[model samples]
Target: MEEGKICRTNPESSDQVKAVHMLLVSYPLQGHITPFIKLAYLIAGRGIMATLVITEFAHARMIASEPDLGNERNKVRYITVPDGLSEDERNDDVKLSQSISEVMPGHLREVIEKVNMEGNQVTCVIADPMFGWAFEIAETMKLKLAIFWTSAPGVLALILSIPKLIEDGIIDTKGSSKLDGKIQLSPDLPPLTSADFLWNYSGNQTPAEIMFQYFFGIHQNLKRSGWLLCNWFHELNPLVGNLVPNMFPVGPLLASGKPAANLWPEDLTCLSWLNKQPAGSVIYVAFGSITVLSQHQMDELALGLELVGRPFLWVKRSDLIKGGSSKYPDGYEERVANRGKIVQWAPQEQVLAHPSIACFLTHCGWNSTMDGLSMGVPFLCWPYFADQFYNRSCICNGYKVGLALSPDEYGIVTRHEIRRKLDSLVADDGIKVNALKLKDMAHRSISEGGFSARYLDNFIQQMKE
Candidate 1:
């Protein structure tokens, strides 16, 4: 943010380059795109040029037709490569992963060639681990390659220790643990049950298997990478950050003046509604962009919120329910009309920062977790899939600033259970204090001369030299 300048330097000669120009690449998912865009802004803030790369389909979906980061200078450029499929074929996670591994590199290579021919050489590429295949293209072009892991460093530590986890028979080749019990991936990290592992929940083994292989590839490439950055902060996860090499913890990665890269149009009306509510009285609910609930589960949640009878803003995404319309329980809206505001989407970071927000009811997606931490908002974790469960563990168990809502045997958070957790969270003064303390730590990590700023500055300096 150095005066919000957009610096693009052309090479005076091969012997003396002026600035670092990075190609920031991310997977098509909203989780991936959010942090990648923030990282782009972070790099560009240092007056280093950045071009954000994604699939043409993602480019159109998440990225609006407007210029990248605004008109005129457009400091960051947006480029797209075909994902080698029709819009219809891109939704299947397994197939999409395969397509990216096998098909995306060639398309990305062409884009790189085009950029080089235009005179701006791509000095570095910062990519999500999901785009591990890009390593080959970087090697082919002899470009500097870095992996931008858009998740907690604890997860990164575990993923890097897969070889040991396998050798010790803690986890099988397919990634399911050999024996189900409390397990510690390493002495320094928190103890984890099989629930923390992303693969166990997927009854289908293909995605799990693919993930295992991806972790393996990432670990293999870790040491050889030009640099590996995590969307995390050292003060937040001191132990894990200290243990991992090239693990520059420079995050809670956010860009000021830029709205979150929302795929769904945000219903900003909620902010006005929040303005009218009492300070620290509203419960903010959002389960990130994905994580659709079943009809039964949705009904339960609707009942639960009504039962809580508190001022709340719920981001019931248009796709909140699978196969069912985003409808409330019968007369649900009227029942809680005075206390609840339901929007398809809202400005999340803005909502969290608002004085009216008390605690968050979230699925514990990493980005949302970071947002909550950044705002000092305590949480009620209701994880649905993937790393969310692990993220929930980090928030509620590791950080001790949140509470977990356990679903019953049928995997539904009962209305009674929801009410109980909501009451418990609102009543917990200790958790609120812990949350604010964590928030101070988070802010300290990003402030001048702090760990995040130092790492970011070091990264830019490394890329420049």
Candidate 2:
């Protein structure tokens, strides 16, 4: 497990062992990076060489968090490419997406060519579908391409149904929703409104237009992709399999023997703090990586946590507040200092898995949703945007394992509402029962003879062919 060494198969092994090498390209974001890394470890465990490619900025953060990230023992090699954005610009979704589309394709091409020249020929290219250009490169190089859909399969189904929506006059070619009421995709699934559309931007039409075009391009590319892999299980959303028949669900891709692929160094101190709290007594609050709360909203959240009067662990990222200053209300820290622990970032999976965690107050991002569900933690959902709304619907309505925090007239989830939600969430035994049920299902999905296990095996077998 030496540093700067690429772990390979043993030379003493039989030559019949096909050197199946996979190149995984992740969209440079925390949520995407974690599952992609887990996928790399999973593939490497199966006697395949997994080369994970990410942006240079993300790589630097990853290395900063874990100095020896891709050691030989992990059996995964790491590579970095320029994302063509400055550190500050990374926060802007539109700018970041534009840069990735414009700048990353050539760099990805160079990486592929260089890897093939090094004798460890990349037999397959597995990439996040956000980077549609990867498909073009793989096609040009005559390499097999498998797209990794990081979000919920339901989200994918929704995106893929865009054409139908347009044809039915529910939406336009530009991806805008024409309806004022909620639309039911199926009788069994939760209903969604126009706001729940993947490309829906509330106020800014420009960003919505940009995102629509971006996803539309990805949608077109998905048809030609050799394989479609999702980071979820059949039991979580069984209807997704019927909706997107070609997709293979092989996840809940949680961390295993290796450290979590975190962009920020996790404060392990929180684990020790959780150890002291009573079982199922603490609320875990985190809004994932990209959610930026307004200053007033941040203050309200702080007051809300205090009002809940429960032991709480909150992950307050450095860039959590919109304008950067995450200042709290007057004497807010002093009032809740004894019961609260705040960190820049936490080991989320471990936190969610902890016995002290009663419920989660989350942004309902797909990765966080999977983590919460797999850990069997009931949720107090506060979704931000895009697929998050859909994930919230799954949590609140479909699965019935969580409750959504309704915002006040001003579009802010006030302290009173937060307190009420937390109170209700912890009191509801039904929610807890459902959460545990999902947890068992999630674990079973990855175990032997499970749907995810069989699909993963099939995917690896396909790689050999």
lDDT of 2 by residue, 1-465 (tens): 222223333232233233677899998888899999988887777777788888878887888897667566776778778778887899787789889889889888888777677677788999998777898898889888999999876678777887888999998988878988988775556887888887775744466777788778778877878688899998877776766656788888877648667899989999999999999999999998878899999999999999989999999999898776778898888889899999999989889989999999999999899999899999999988778888888899899999999989999999999999899999999999999999999999999999898898899898888
Clashes by residue pair, model 2:
none
- Compared to the true structure, candidate 2 yields what TM-score? 0.94
- Kindly report which residue stretches of model 1 are placed more than 4 angstroms away from their true locations once superposed: 1-18, 65-69, 72-74, 186-188, 202-210
Q: What is the TM-score of each predicted model, taking all chains together?
A: 0.92, 0.94
CA shift at 5, candidate 2, in angstroms?
12
Q: lDDT (CA) for every model shown?
A: 0.79, 0.84
lDDT of 2 at 459: 93
Candidate 2, lDDT over the whole model: 0.84
lDDT of 1 by residue, 278-337 (tens): 999999989987788888888888898888889989888767888768667778888899
List candidate 2 stretches off by more than 4 Å: 1-18, 203-207
Tell me, by lDDT, which candidate is best. Answer: 2
